[model samples]
Target chain A: MTAAALPRTTVDRRPPLGGFSLTYLALEIRRVLRNRRSLFFILIMPAVFFLLFGLPQKGQNIDQANSAAAIAYIMISLAVYGAMTASTATGGAVAVERAQGWSRQLRLTPLRPPAYVATKVLSALSLSLLSVLVEFVVGSIGGVRMPAHVWLLAGLGAWLGSLVFAALGLFVGYLAPAENVMQFMGPILALLALFGGLFVPLEVLPHVMRTIAKFTPVYGVGSIARSPLTHDFSWVAVLNVVGWTAFFGLGAALLFRRDTARV
Target chain B: MRTDTLAASETTGTRTPAVLLRGLTKKFGAVTAVNQLDLRIEPGEVVAFLGPNGAGKTTTIDMMLGLARPTQGSVEVYGLAPTEAINQGRIAAVMQTGGLLKDVSVAEIVRMTASFFANTRPVDEVLERAGIADIADRRVAKCSGGQQQRLRFALALLPDPDLMVLDEPTTGMDVEGRRDFWNAIRTDAQAGRTVLFATHYLEEADAYADRIVLIRKGQVVADGTASEVKALAAGRQVRATLPGADEVRLAALPGVDRAEVRGETVLLHTNDSDGVARYLLTQTTARDLEITSRNLEDAFLALTSGEDTDLEGVSR
Candidate 1:
């Protein structure tokens, strides 16, 4: 290690997009994709639930719609659940990265903090999309027959609505210890799914449970997703998704700044 | 844009110091981790920050790398804020530990780090230079501590930074690993890139650093070349064979800083070895008297130990 030339490479200062790069996002995605256990939970678990619950309801039709409508509703609910789980897991993984000091390592690089956050969101969104598509494919195989536009709109709604969970995941990741983050999130998500009417329809439930479900973040997502098929579009669902996104996004940003600002 | 700033400054022919910290203070609740510390490093100097555990070495390094912010004062890297300097790829760091991802292969992490910098050395070259090319395929979780450290070094090298700040860079390495790592760092330092490394190892500071900054209790107690720091804690030890020697009385004697009875022989640490030698030989039936100048270890203890906690006129 002697007589080596100085490292005098020309500086390429491209700060547009705040040092964001697809190469890094690809690597981040690749790491999660390689985790077979997580993939099972994010992609396979929802499909399993859909098969378990939706198959029994395959021959039934409610409100005089097609028999496939009941199965499609279950598929959409599972899709929302799967997409949220995928994104939240990806976002919540930040706690582990923080615990390992990888976050500190990244701060030393040219990658800005905003770029890191953006990469994480993109990475989570990618996995969320995959989770949603996996359910859709399974739904199609299981005789879920919706019009082409409903499939696209419902899939798009489920995938896009998952941005709220992505932010929630990041917030929880930064808030909770790495070991306890998923443990805390798992039960909370299940409860949210139940209260949001993703598990059982609000119609069958008592009046009080139905009233309280509307306030949960998951209810808004479920309404937006089911609106395309049910034709029951409401501005309240949009408010719920947008409001929770801002709330969790703000919380995550504050926690992130605090985490990086101290030892 | 940062390159343009650098090129402009170069044309003016006044080289900016690689790092400049002025009255830097960091407080975590009631504990003041770094207390108004000031340091300046010019380009090409390999300086060592020597301190014991909990002596604010990590905190100071954290502030310099923009991983933590200072509560008071300022840190400038090449005349820019720490984050700005880092964003410009003018500075990089090889932190003590836990920086590499466990599931990722060594090569993959290196490639990922290289992507963060718009201008970086080739990934393979950095891997080879850090001497981790052979283990590049191994997952970080499977790699040994030394291998992980080398991988961290490789990531730092990706940007080809002008200033490298390392916090205990050779912590988990073996003897030979430490030697090889320092050899690589020395080669880099010789090429006019400034390096500041924090370490608790006295020998690392003695052997590698052009200057040593000895810190204790969140303040610098001694700062100079290896020999200069040794000279700062100037003293000598006088040894004599005395049966049933009273260590307390000997320590109370004029010019005797400390005295210890080591079985048959009594060792007296003192500034005035002549006085200690005269007292031991004449006042007692002592024989086989010998005196020696203090080494760096003795100097380290003399300056760093004790509760004086005075912070004035100590630094060079």
Candidate 2:
């Protein structure tokens, strides 16, 4: 009506590809950051628990020679715990979205389909990395310090752990019916993480349970993460962790895409 | 099916249609949600699509909005393929659920969605237009159902799109809310946007739409102005109290299609019962006669009444 600026309609028709990517990323980050509960899950609860659990058990609890080595093992094992947290959070979120038709709404939007899976996995990775970073700082203050190399190893293990469980979480998110998402997701992750040695070391498991754990993805993630702490850096364990992550991620993505075709 | 012939047919007073769908069919597995359907909508017009539950109105809207693909035929919005054009940011739709993100506020939702269009209406003006300005700060999840509908209206108005398609926009709204919502739509139509709406409330369409199109079993059975459609519902009915009325003679009269004699009341159904009543008054000793014409409800019932609707295949 008055002397004015250019209207936004045509201006919005095409932003650069990067801008669209960032928009999708921003929307996801914004939603996750808005709730106090997600903040607690993302920052406080994991970091505090990792510190409380990692300090006292740093050296004497593991029978390892050096405190650095024992601390690394604990840090690596905690990656599995981080993965479990992501799985539970994301699984619950997706199931809630399904119930409230939020997933259907997202499907209708112009957001690229692959971006949905990619964004959640990456967000979970970033969060777990932050959690492990906090745990390392706390471990240092609590009379456990590692060489710079071990710190770098902890970051990598944390990210890899995030991917493995995020993919698992995505699968469970889709497969569980909306009503029982909590009931199913919690027990499944708890049992798998326990057997993978987050709550109990693999050395303490019974013979049958210990053997069965070798085939599980949690075992793959935990063993790889633990190798970083022990400075073992087993190539086979690393490959197994990465391989299962890709397999689960792809399977979950295809399932998500197929279910949304109607939506 | 020929566009040129249809265009030729279009130019002889009706003008080129704003939308045309020829044999629009969409099937998911074995369910043919939108069967082969042919439909045309014109510019500066409002059309209401009416059908029973699971009658494929939402499926048809989905195809038209380019959310889903057609299995057998094609759909065009203003002569452009719906999918490609909508992705390019042309037509705008207000869907069920309002398509509003729960975490975002009403203002943020409008601002983000409006960024997708060029020559978009101003954000503040759209806020006022959708009547959500008072609670623009409210999260979409926190708004009342009707306020949520208005926020969606704001989003649809952002692009100032040539065509606006709404599917069950007023489903969970209160009466005044529906009124305010349609009032905003009427303003959009006044701005020359072609408005297409789907509703189970026959009266909503009757009040706002310039024309009503009723679909049954995935096909268009009636499409015309309200009165014209009403006239097609076996037209009007005329009942007369005639003194020993000659039922056979009246049944045989011009323009009178059917007649029933019930005691003193002689009932006549015709395409033009008014004319029939005039003729009857002059020709017989009919004491008291009442004539009534079909309304949109009657027209809707008449068209959908014949189709086989099992409501089996459509999901919600």
Candidate 3:
């Protein structure tokens, strides 16, 4: 009965959008990084790859291609790997939330849907950066060199790669069946990376594989990422990455809206 | 089952409640989950929504929280829409699934969830209230089911919401854990916060709820307190231990609805237990006679028939 006398806590409806994105980003980072498995997958795997692959690519069959090409492609491949893994994890996380009714929980709370989505985007983007940096340092320590401006291409490639792959993951997270999320992602991403010129140069792949690689998202991301590695700019590769990002970005959002409509 | 007995002042004459609903409905594909649901939850009262599986409890909670757009109705929490109410952090929920991220310490999830609100409760105070102080540093994935449930309770409490909603919150708990969970619920209710509880556990509602609303086939079937519901159970049962030669005699009771003989004992069922008991004692050598009043389950069964069709189909 004394509850009537207790000061009530009213919800603040008009909070400015200040740092809301940061709050979400911070939360996602904390949650994802806290997972030992996620940490290994996100941080350690890329660094290991950089040490393993970044250093050895130069020792492998030598190419007249710019040392920047090798370093850039390594960065691009690592970035794609990072984005793909993060998206897969994030998509799986979203699927789990859907199954467990967590989204419904947020829907009932004061957290906006856009805020939630924005947080996922920022987290994946950041993780991609972290993974890229770790790989970059490993490659540099192993004696790979890039001019300062050449570094910008690596950054752009990594960022665009994150957006494109992260958007694909967002779309899949909403659209995929709850039970099959884990089983489908690894093979699909591996195949894309293998054919789209992440593992082997597109020029070295069989003609059929090269044809199939053109439409895959990896081609877009890999082309831009590999630009510094090769002296030549691959606008088509950049366009492919941008196109896939936009395609999957819009598609995933639409699926999410459709999926949540049932809630 | 009739809700007319609720004092008009308590619901009708009262001001706008903390949570209000007018014919909310949610649908998936062709299947409609919630039907027409008109409810009012005032601050400081605990209201239990009782229903069986697939009765749309989750869907209704979703509409109130603004997770799902009502196909037909509107939900107002803290005088605003569900999503709007959440944005203000005026509302909180203990969802069916624990939203705490696996691999992180429980303390971290609490801190992040608390940051979402402007006037959050202190971290330790909230943690202690949820009985999760000892496990604050443990990774969330390592916690026991009871611990996870308690951790979620802590997260929900961090915001110190005006309107708190729970969806099947005790699904994976043991007896002692359930008691601890109810303790948290009672604490919130005692604080004068409005609580909307959706549970299948009859005892939880029977023991704690100020009012109970029963939904069957997506429609509100009965709305009242436990006593009010039990009062509607008009049927009664009679049992007697008659010494030998009882089968034929018991069948001849004056107002018996059903009669069955098992060895030396005869059992009779009648709406008029007093009349039947009197006859059994006087007309025959029936010893060890016993009579008990009808329980809520009797009333519940009488109220809801199996295979009942859908209820209100309003969209949010």
Candidate 3 lDDT, B160-181, residue by residue in tens: 7777788878887899989988
| DockQ of all predictions against the true structure, Cα-based | 0.39, 0.21, 0.33
TM-score per model over all chains: 0.84, 0.85, 0.80
- Tens-digit lDDT track of model 2 for A121-185: 66666666655666556556666666667667666766556677778777777766474575666
The interface RMSD value for candidate 3 stands at 3.3
The digit string of per-residue lDDT tens for model 3 on A1-263 reads 22441365454643345325465577677777766777787778876777677766665433664434464466557766766676657655677666655665555445556767777787877777776776666667777666877677766676657777788778878887573575677678778778777766778988998899898987777667666656667777767877888898899889888876744
Superposed Cα deviation of residue B269, candidate 2 (Å): 1.5
Number of the predicted model whose TM-score against the real structure is largest: 2
In model 1, the clashing pairs are: none
Scored against the true structure, residue A66 in model 1 reaches a CA lDDT of: 34
Evaluate residue A34 in candidate 3 and report its C-alpha lDDT on the 0 to 100 scale.
66
Best candidate according to lDDT: 1
Native-referenced Cα lDDT, model 2 = 0.68
DockQ of 2: 0.21
The residue ranges of model 3 lying beyond 4 angstroms of the native Cα positions read A1-10, A13-15, A18-23, A36-43, A46-93, A179-183, B7-12, B23-35, B71-74, B235-292, B306-316
Sorted by DockQ (best first), the order is: 1, 3, 2
